[model samples]
Target: MNEITVSLPDGSKRSLAAGATILDLAASIGTGLAKAAIAGKVDGNLVDLQTPLADGATVEIVTEKSPDALHIIRHSTSHLMAQAVKQLFPQAKVTIGPAIETGFYYDFDLEKSFSPEDLEKIEAKMRELAKADLKIEREVLSSADAIELFRTMGEDYKVELIQDLGAESVSLYRQGDFVDLCRGPHLPRTSLCKAFKLTSLAGAYWRGDEKRAMLQRVYGTAFADKKELEAYLARIEEAKKRDHRKLGRELDLFSFNDEVGAGLVIWHPKGAMLRTILEDFERREHLKRGYDIVLGPQILKTELWQRSGHYENYRENMYFTTIDEQGYGIKPMNCLSHMMIYKSQLRSYRDLPLRFFELGTVHRHERAGVLHGLLRVRGFTQDDAHILCTPDQLDAEIKGVLSFVRDVMGIFGFDYEMELSTRPEKSIGSDEDWERATSALLSALKDSGREFEINEGDGAFYGPKIDIKLRDALDRRWQCATIQCDFTLPERFELTYVDADGEKKRPVMVHRVILGAIERFIGVLIEHFAGNFPTWLAPVQATIVTVTDNQIPYAETAFNTLRAAGVRVQKDFRNEKLGFKIREAQLQKIPYMLVVGDKEVEAGLVAPRFRDGKNLESMTPEQFIAFIQDEVKSYR
Candidate 1:
């Protein structure tokens, strides 16, 4: 037989028959590897184990332990799910199904909406199909033939997709009696998708267009083994318990009303207090870091947005209104006004770095379907700031923002990851400007000594950015802080500074936010702490509970004293039993509960009980106030 040489990932070469498959290569290496291999990567592209190996190509075996294994498993499981759904409901038409970061989902064009019972049945069928160990084969066909095949199968959505591709040929994957249009690099057998579960179902618009037909989306997840699947399910359960919307009502923090409109948050008293505390912290931090607090109008002339490229690139997310026969666009961002501030005066290199901070409230036209509780709300306030600096000062300014993000996230006990996002296809500015902006951000990220990922083509419309995603207690990542380096915006707005050499130069703008949207951050905080906010952050630090009505006077005195001393204290002198009051306070997640009884009133002291059922030594109200202050200072 003719011989061919192929390179392994470890840079070793092996000679095999000319038409050798990846499976052949694996078996040539070892029986152990051949048994473990589920897929392979040939020259950096994933392929099935049976794919023909090209001479001189580098190959890496993908086992269950490989990083790529889960994605392939999840994607194959999605097909498995579709096959099961089709078998159960013969008339169901399959749409797109792809693996997401968390799991996979497939949309079905069926008149009957799937119920919980249906999901159970579909999952059972999937397990049976996996046990059957059906062979999964990939085939190529001309576009015309593929369309006819799908049309014959009554999968109109697949037909439309093929037509949209306008390709000469397409790939399809088949297992048992089920065949579907896909770009195949899937599991070779159904049995490999054993550790899978159908999670939930939801309604989705076909191709995400509201005008299109609504389809039923069945969501699911797959793992390499049952143990990993169990762990993920446990986390999902914990996430449900920490769900902010549920805790928001239970803790009396925030709410939304359909009458008021979707994606709008109405902060109750406690919620408002929480926001006030965070906003106050932001102001103090900014002031300490040499940022000047600034404010801008809520709406600007529509021409300004057009000049900033928001009209062309971001108009869909913005709201516009005509005021007194003049068109105005509600601000979706705070940078435009900050840029105008820099333009208001001729700056010199002596004042090269000017940081303008604002706790600005902005509005966006979020679609109703994507409107999440507080995270994806239309109206929210951002701890936004813009730093304009000379080209020489750009590096330090970027690092300063990085340090700021580190300090703030550390204070909140959030472990975060950073991503350097490059320019997108719809972005503005010359290639040189985008390159410079991206380079500056990348340089600072490297100097920070922290690992980050490259997120290509996800930058802002004007420039590149460093996006910070904070991981919460349950290991879920939340998008919070961002540092955007924009040379284009300053150039467009004509922002300039006098160079040391007596020449006019445009200063680079670094737009950033530490906490991002206050509403969203609070929601994250709620879940992170599980409503058990630390002493400093709790809206009510302590509630004064009386054992009897006779101790009301003492409880009232303690509350007044604590309030006067800057403690967020509440009085719970209701005629309820002492245990009941304590239980209620504990349910509220208060950090401290001061128990006032006749014995304590006689001694002019109160007992402090922590919400976790720990008791502090009995002390006078003044002493407790000092202790609370010490605790707050400790956090700082």
Candidate 2:
């Protein structure tokens, strides 16, 4: 037999038959590996265990420990589901099945509508197929032969897909009696898919085109280990309990009225109070940092946006209106408005970096399917700002923004990960300009000593950008801070300043938002702290519960004093048991509960209890006030 050298993960080489499969290599190594092997990586591309080896090639057997093996398993599970569908509904035409973020989905076009009963039947068939432990086999054929096979098999979607294949051959996989048109790196046998569950079913347009066939898509999730699968299901249950939409209703935070609009969120009293507190804290911080607050209009002439290039690229997301027979658009970004402000005045090198800030509410029309609570809503307020400066001033401006982002995130006790997104394929500006902007962004992140990954070809059309993701209490990451560099917007809008050289040059624009959207950030805050906001930020911070009617007078006095001190105090003087009143306050997650009884009243003292059930000894009312004040001050 012809022999070939296979490179192993340990930097060692092994000689084997040139046409050998990955299973053969694993068997040579040990039974343990052969049993554990799920697939193979040949020259870095995932493939089946039966692939013929290339001479002097790299090979690594993928096992449960391999990171990408989960995706391989999910892909295979999707195929298995499709196979089950085909087995049950022989007339069901399979289209495409792909691995998703946390699951897999397969689309099928069937004459009859599928119901919950059908899902149960499909799942039972899947388990039956899994128990068979049938070997998964692969076949490669010429393009013409593959097309003919799909055509003969009555898979029109597969035939349509094969027409686009410019390659000489295509691969197909089969297990038991069900064969599929796929390029798979599937498990060796059906038994390897130990745990999986069908999640849901939805209607999707073929290729997302409504004109095409409406396909029924079945979604499912798979895992390598059963314990992890159970844990994931448990987390999903916990997430459902903590969902902001449901929590918002239970907490009376906000509401969306269909009569008003789809994406417009109306903050209720409690929510508005929270917003005010958050905004107040941010305003004070900005003022101390020498940031100049400015205002901009909600509507601008379409000509202005055209100059800013928003009309060309982002117009689809913008809301356009006609006024005075001229087209106008509701702003989707604050950068354009700030740019117009900078252009309104002349500046010299002495005024190098000008930071103009706004809590701008902007409108962007999003698809109906993508909206989820406040997290993905349209028409939201952004804590947005723009800095116009020269290349010499870029570093300091970046440092300032970084420091602000860090301080803000730090306030919430948020730990963050960073990503630097570079230019996209269809972006504006010269190649040289794009390179410089990307370099500036990367340098800022490096200088700050922040670890970041590069997201290639994911930047905004005008410039490269830096994005910050904060891991919440659930360990779920949410992208909240964005720092972008824009050269094209300034040039397009003819925004410039005079340098020491006495010549006019376009100023570079830096758009940054520390807290992306007030609504989304507030929603995140709800989940992060489980609705127990910090003392200063809480809508109702302290509740004074009286032990009896005699103590009610003292509670009222104490509440009055606390309110005058701006402590967010409330009086709970209802004729009820002290324990019941305390329980009510705790349920609301109020940061503090002050208990007043006749003995404490006579002693001019009170008992302090933190919302988390920590207690303090009886203290003078004056001491209690001082302690709560100190806690609030420390929060700032």
Candidate 3:
């Protein structure tokens, strides 16, 4: 046999027959490894275990312990599910299926809706198929032939996909009588999808197009082991309990109405007050950092957007209007206004590092299906800021933004991860500018001494950026803050400052948002605390509950006193029982409940009952104020 040399990831070389497959190499190495190996990576590309080896190729066998193994298993599991569905309901036609972040989902074109019992049956069939251990073989065929085959099978969606792809050849995976069009690096056999479960079902538009047919989507998750699957299921249960949409309604925070509009939030009184407190805190922090608060018009001329590159890259997501028969675009970002402000006057290098901040409201055209409560909305406010500085001060400004993000996340008790996103395919700016911007972000991340991963091809259209994802109490990550370094915008807008030599030089622009969007941040916060906000951030810090109508006057007086002392107080002066009032207050998630009874009123004191059912000794209103203030101070 002709011999070939293959290099392993650890710098070891193996001489094997040219016709040898990855599985053969694994078995030759060790029995345990061959048994554990699910797939292999050849020359940095994932391939099936049975792929033929070539000379001077780099190979790495992927076992259950590999990070990429779960994804492969999940993708294979989705195929298994599709096969199971076909076996149970032959009339059901399969569409597209892909492995998502949570797990996987496959869409099917069927006349009947899938029920919970159907999911169980399909799951049982999947297990049966896995037990059979059928080999999954890949074959390449001309697109024309594949289209004809799917057409004969009554799978119009598959034919549509093939036609839309416009490829001359396509890859198909076959397991017994089941076959799917895919560019697959699937498991060698069905049994490798050991631990799997069908999660839920929903309706999705074909290819996310409203005009296309609606397909039934079955969601599922698979793991390398049973323990991991169980843990993921537990997280799903906890996630359901902590869903912000459910909590928003239960806690009376915000609402969306069909009558008004879709993807629009209507904040209730309590919710509005909570938002006010957050905005005030943001203003104070910005002022302390020497940011000049600024405001701009809600709309600008279309020519300005065209010049700013927004018209070319972001026009689809922007709302346009006509003012006096002239085209204008609704502002989707606040950076343009800040740039105009900087250009309103030319100054020396002494005016460098000028920071402008705004709690600016902007509008975007968010799709209806993607909108979920406050998480995705059409109109929302951003805690946005822009910094104009000389090139020498760019690094320090970038570091300052990272510091702000760290401090803010810490204050909210959020553990976060940072990622540096590089230039995308659909981006502006020259290669040199992108490299400089990315390097500045990389240096800042290194100076901060925090580990960050690189997200290739995921930056803003004009620049590279640092994205911060905060992990909530449930351990789920939320993307809420970002720092973008832009060299293109300054040049596009011709923003310049006079240097010491009196020469015109372009200033660097930094676009950042501590809380990406007010609505989304509040939504994340709701789930992070499970509707139990801290004393300082709570809508009602204290609620005074009276035992009976006789104590209403004292409760009223106590409420006034607490409110006068700058506490957010609510009075429950109804003719209800003491336990009933306390239960109501606890249901509202109020931090402290002041119980006003005859003994407490006579003693010139009010007993404090915490939301957690802890009872404290009676104290004067002044003393309670001091105690609450101390708690607030602790948070700061």
Candidate 4:
């Protein structure tokens, strides 16, 4: 046999017999490496260990410790799950399964819905298959042959998918009697799929189209080891306990009614108060940052949306109506009105950077299936702002917004990541404008010295943007802030300012939101804090619990004094026992409870007890009011 030379990741070369596979190369290095090898990377592309290494090809042996290991393991585990499902329910047909960010999911079309008991059986079967350690092999066949093979197996979905692929050849992976159509690079054997668990089941439309057949989606996750899997499961349990919807109901914050409609939030008193506090904070922050408070009409002429490219690019998400023979669009974005405001005035270069801020309420037609409690609602308010600045000033404006995001996230004790999304295929604007806008955002992000990833082809239709995703207590990412740079929209609306040379020049617009949506942020906060809001943010900061009927008069006096002094205080004077009232208040997550008894009345003081069972020293009403004020100011 002829000798072949292959390049290792460390830039070293190894001579082996021609047609040597990646597994053979691993063995050549060391026996331990061969045993640890689960897959291989050939010239940066993941491949099976059986893949032949071409002469002089760059290769890296993938072990369980590699970053790509989990994805490959999860993908293979999905196949393991599919094989189990097929063995248990031969009537069920498989469609597609792919590894997602958190885990993997496989979709199945069956006449019966999957129950929890069925999941257990399927999982048990998967364990059995894994224990058998069946050798998994990949095979390529002509598209026509692939379709015929799936058709014989009664997999209509697979056949349809293969036909739609319109390819000359297709690859399929087979383990035992079970086979699935997929791209290359899976585990060599079934037993490698050890640390896996089927998390949940959901109903998903085939290909995400509501008109198509609904399929059962089995969600599962796989880790490199059992310890990591256990940790993930523990986090998931904690997440369930901290779910915002459950906390909302328990804390009497918000609700959604069928009578009102889907994706619309009905805020209760406490929820409304929380929202108001957040909005007030946004206003003060914006004002301090030199933003001019502004408001726009809820509905605008549809022609304006068309002129702004929204009607052409985003019409599906917009609501339209005819008012007095004039077509109108309920504003789904606040950019158009801000543009109108810019064009409303004649300006010089001195007035170049006009920052207009609005706590704008907008409506979008969100699909019912995607809407969650308050996170993905149709009707919501945004802390939206637009900064119209000269081209030279664009970088500063964007960095300012980045600084604003950093400060706000720090205040909330949240760690966040940023992604720079570039132009999408369906976006509007000239290539030159798109490049300029993308470059501006990129420059600002780089100058800020913060690491960010480039998310390709996910930008808004008009321009590129920086998306800020904040990590919560469970390390889950939520889309909270965004900064979008647009050179096209100002040109579309013909917004111009006089330059130093007295020539009218088009100004660039930076549309940004520090906290993307008020409702979503509040939901994130509820989950982040687990409904135990800090003293400053608690809707009812303090409550007065009278020791007995004799103390009601004193409790009422204390409550009125606190209320007058600007404390969010409530009184529990229903003639209840002190401990009972204290327990109820604690359940409500009130920050402080002031107990009024005969002794308290005599001393003209209140016994303050913290929700965590710590007792503050007795203080007069005036002194307590000052303490609360000081605590609130500390958050600021």
Candidate 1: deviation at residue 90, Å?
0.6
Give candidates' CA RMSD values in order: 0.9, 2.6, 1.6, 1.1
Error of 4 at 156 (Å): 0.8
Summarize candidate 4's per-residue lDDT along 160-264 as a digit string, tens digits: 889998999999999999999999689999999888899999989999999999999999999988999999999999999999999999999999999999989
| Candidate 2 Cα deviation (angstroms), residue 306 | 1.4
User: By the TM-score metric, which is better: model 2 or model 4?
Assistant: 4
**Tens-digit per-residue lDDT, 1-636, candidate 2:** 589888998899988987888988888899999988888998889988887888888999999889889998889889888989999999999999998877899999998898988988988888888888989989889989989988998999998887887778998888987888888878888878878888788988888886888899998899998897898788777777778888788778899999988988999988899999988887888888877899899999999888776787788899999988999999998887787788788888788688898999999998775677889899898888899999888878888899998998888989999999999986788888898899999999999997899999999989999999999877888989999998777777777788888998878889999898988899899888878888878998888888888887777887887788777877888899888988888877788898998888988887889988999898876787788788888966
Tell me the tens digit of each residue's lDDT in model 3 across 1-636.
589999999999999987999998899899999999889999999988888999899999999899889889999999999999999999999998999888999999999999999999999999999999999998989999999999999989889889999999999999989999998789989988899999999889998999988899999999988999999999899888888899888888889999999998999988998899899989998998889999998999999999999999999899999989999999999999999899898767999899999999999999888888899999999999999999999999999989888888899999999999999999899999999999999999999998999999999999999999999987888999999999999999999999999999999999999989999999999989988999999999998888878777777888888899999998988877778888888888999999888988898788998999999988998899999999999988
Q: Can you tell me which runs of candidate 1 are displaced by over 4 Å?
A: none
Clashes of each: 0, 0, 0, 0
Clashes in candidate 4: how many? 0
TM-score for every candidate vs. truth? Answer: 0.99, 0.92, 0.97, 0.99
Residue 257 CA displacement from its true place in model 4, Å: 0.9
Q: Which residue ranges in model 2 land beyond 4 Å of their true spot? A: 89-91, 110-121, 142-156, 163-169, 201-203, 210-216, 547-551, 576-580
lDDT against the true structure, each candidate: 0.93, 0.87, 0.92, 0.93
